[model samples]
Target chain A: MKIEAMPAEKAARAGGRPGSEALQRRLAVAFAGALVVVTTLSLTVFETARRALASSRLVAHAHEVLQVMNGVEGTLVTAQSAVRGFVITGDEVYLRDRDSALLSLESGVQRLRDLTADNDSQRRRWQALRDRLDERVALLDRLVVIRQTEGAGRAREFLRSVYPPPPPAKTGRIRAITGEMAREEELQLAGRMREEELASAFAVASGVVLAVLFALMFTLGYLAIRRRVAQTFGLNAALLSRTEEAEAANRELEGFSYSVSHDLRSPLRAIDGFSRMLTEDYGERLDDEGRRRLAVVREGSQRMGRLIDDLLEFSRLGKKPLACSAIDMTALAGEVYRELRTADPEGSPAFDLAPLPKGWGDAAMLRQVLANLLSNALKYVRKDRAPRIEVRGWAEDGRNVYCVKDDGIGFDMAHYDKLFGVFQRLHSAEFPGTGVGLAIVQRIVTRHGGKVWAESKPDEGSSFYFSLPQAAMSGFTDPPAARGGRR
Target chain B: MNRSRNVLLVEDNPYDVELTLRAFEQNNIMNELVVVRDGKEALDYLFGAGAYAGRDLGDAPEVVLLDLKLPKIDGLEVLRRMRADERTRRQPVVVLTSSSEEKDVVSSYNLGANSFVRKPVDFTQFTEAAKQLGLYWLVLNEPPPGG
Candidate 1:
């Protein structure tokens, strides 16, 4: 029983047990244990009560037998005296006394027989006593009859002829039999009383043991509940402090970013502006090498400026809460495509845009994702041929999956792991990029609870995929339903 | 161009001050430009007190190009004080600063700034921004009745 509850206790500790379930199990175990103890106590008390009842019956039986034996003895003595009186005085009143004594003795002997019937030894002794009483009564009757018929002289002569005088041993024989039955009943009563004492002691001991066990279980259960409550209190306090610490750290980080926004850019602006001035103002006096050095410095400063802007934008995503709603994928893609077309007017990429499914996300962030992915497809292309890009979307596995496939200068699959990393570039010089674009894209997609991946080969086309949860497409915020349009 | 109309350039950076002057010169706006190094000097010039105690307040600048980060009093506080006084309240103050944080922009507009523009790191963009500032505030847009 104890081993069975161990797993439940472990589950409670592991936080796998729900609050009510753990409490219910604990209460049930406690109740079951208490029930077992109470039932055992009840059974023990019941057995003690039965034993006490039997002991009481034995006591009553012994008392009744003793009383009946005394009555029989008294009646026998009285009858013997009556018979003797009648023989000596030849009186009719003495005969009446013997008759009344004989009647009482007969009833007493019958009661003794009934009482001693259950005990073999007692019944045998009773039978022997009954036989002796019958013999004595017969002698008494014969003497009385003799006295009434022949007169006092003849009755006395008959008695002397049967025995020279009354034999004392013979007359005391009935008294001895009654005395023996009474002594046996007294012995049985003493034995029954001792057993009653022992049984009473055992019942008291069981009551004490049950009380102690109840106290122990109650104390243990109380301590267990208190300990669980205290542990929960400690855990809550720790969680509160940890949340406060995290908030403080977030505030400090915001301050740092503010400084980065203000202080870091000022110097870079000065460097680029001063270097530009140097190039325009003193280019005539400086040699080719100096102009080139100045050009390199300007390029480095501009590149650093772009890197700082991208880094700040990336960090801003983390600080801002997402504004999620149903997104019109087709409209968003169309807008981004127009902007991309305006951005790169020289490279004419053949764009094939298929119907896109309605998705759920922040519209602005999703636009950024489309912008980055599409522009990436546009940017990484073989200079020899025109860029062929296809944008399509579908719903699968409870997600809206969008794919951007492009016939571009694809990358080696070995370095695919670093594709979404910040500041990681496959082709640094040939492709002019800060490499933070894909990282930002991944961050925005991930914030919307989506995943991004790519399939690319060295010379073949590359396809990039991102999926958003379809559950986010709510009926209330869906633009298509609101507009009542097929698009 | 209105050579007599004054344009105040309140900036702490010497390089930026020089760049702004070059941008204005290239744009061929020969307006009388008054350059102050910090907020205090700019306030003094506008209120005609402390250093410019004898100057006339009637010759207020046509436009004030204010930088936010400064040595003494910052630009937003200057704008707040300017808006408080009737003499400088309606003056065209455009916030030109290195910081483009949303808080700064919102606060600048709230404090009665006419416009807010972040200083571009690329000098060419800065030059174009300066040219537009000169043409729009000094030449195209109509000023308040008193200023």
Candidate 2:
């Protein structure tokens, strides 16, 4: 059986989409929520501190008012005792004590006025207390003078006036005033105690609420971070699995390629060898028609050899690592053009070589790309007109832009999408290509992280452009002369 | 000078062996070509072991034509054993295989093979190659003296 070589398939596998956008959205929501929680917690803390400070101030004011009331009551009792002692003993010592008590009473009344500054009701009560104390003091002074001069009888009269065994109306009025003052003091103390209670309660509640809120915020923040880490781990695992699968597929393909090249070639060689032997041993006995048919078989086997060679070259490109370095665009283009000219020296084609920016790239691969483009341009030129080819380059937006323009049998814009695909051809077999040149160029460009495209119109002209990253330029230097010299 | 030289041909395929024998006849090598279908037979012929135990070890072939792929024992193992033995270390072993793989070529040279040649598919080319090789090894090239 005649063994026929099948061409290698060249379809690219599609890639999976990433979930970066969803992760970004979740991160943003988490950040905003954290900000709100922090703000609310801070405000609660501030209010709690303010209330604590206000309650302390109220406590201090209530204590001061209580001290003044105690001093006033003590002074009234001391003065009444001194006056009664003088009246009973008829002694100057008691009279002196009565005068000193009068001095203490006046000062106590002044202090009561100062301590009750915040309350109008307490102030009015203090004024009434002061008036009553002054009346008592005046009666005591008269009794003291009488005791010094008129003896017990006049002293007794003065004492009666000062002590006032009591007019019911006046006593009731004084008692009412004292009651009002006591009530006012009690009210002030009660108000201060209420504020303290409220402040304590508010502080405790705010502390509890803030603690819970902060804890919740912290927990949520931690959870968000953990989730993000988990998602990252998942993404990494998925990427790792994809990489492993691709590596496995690549290894399988390599094995298959080697087996095809080695095992398949052996049988093909036998077929070719045996067939040749038949023609050699029995040629004279055969007719011209038979010889022609045998020639067809030989030609078919040779075509199969060419197909195998092309397939091997295609797979080799995938496994081969690129050697990247700085490449002088102008020099590289000139070298390719020179080779094209030598291959078809008699064919008239005006060439325009422009000054080109240097770029980082693989020298051999770049040379291949340029050779393919120039040869294609030369092959497709209009039959009537002389071929014209132009090569130019420049830096734009931190990238190197290279273009090859030609006056040729340009293709329709509708078929532009098919140009870079493997085995996709617009021209007939007569043009003499395996329809793999452009596809190879695209693969090399993509490996370099660059983009390539073409613009053309039928029967007019075509221009191919490609862009490469500027950063790649620093490592690669152009070969002073093309390595494989002009063809 | 006219003494017929002994040649050992190690190959698996009968067709390839037939073609090689025809090539040798057409080229007038005038040598007693010894055929070994696999590496085991080749080893037996060289070492005088197994079925060839009664043969003289000193009467080794002038040249051993080795094929890389064989059924019982591979050609590389046979070549390795030949190079290791003092009695047959200097024996001329030529690699004649269908594969032009770089690894095979490199390995044959590394293992002390006297020469390496890929068998051409075309009958005419194969015959021409055999003629040149026969002249070079059997007629022109000198063999090492028996130990």
Worst 10 residues of 2 chain A by lDDT: A1-10
DockQ of each: 0.51, 0.22
- Looking at candidate 2, what TM-score does chain B attain? 0.95
> Which prediction has the highest lDDT against the true structure?
1
Error of 1 at A325 (Å): 1.8
> For candidate 1, lDDT tens digit of each residue in A1-487?
0123444544556474347567768867776776777888888889988988888888888888888888888887889788889888878899899999999999999999999998888889999998988988888888888898888998888777776757455657777887888888888889888978988898889888986787676776677677677877766666666567767877787777778877888788788888988999999999999999999998888888888888888878777777766667877787788888897787778999998998777777888899999998888999899999999999999899999999998899899999999999987677888999999999989888899999999778799999998777755554652121112
CAPRI tier for the interface of model 2: incorrect
Task: Highest TM-score: give the candidate number.
Answer: 1
Evaluated at residue A209, the lDDT of candidate 1 is: 95
lDDT of 1: 0.84
List the global CA lDDT of all models: 0.84, 0.75
A272-378: candidate 2 lDDT, tens digit per residue = 65666678879888899987887777655655655665566666666678777666778888988888789788679999999888767778878878888888889
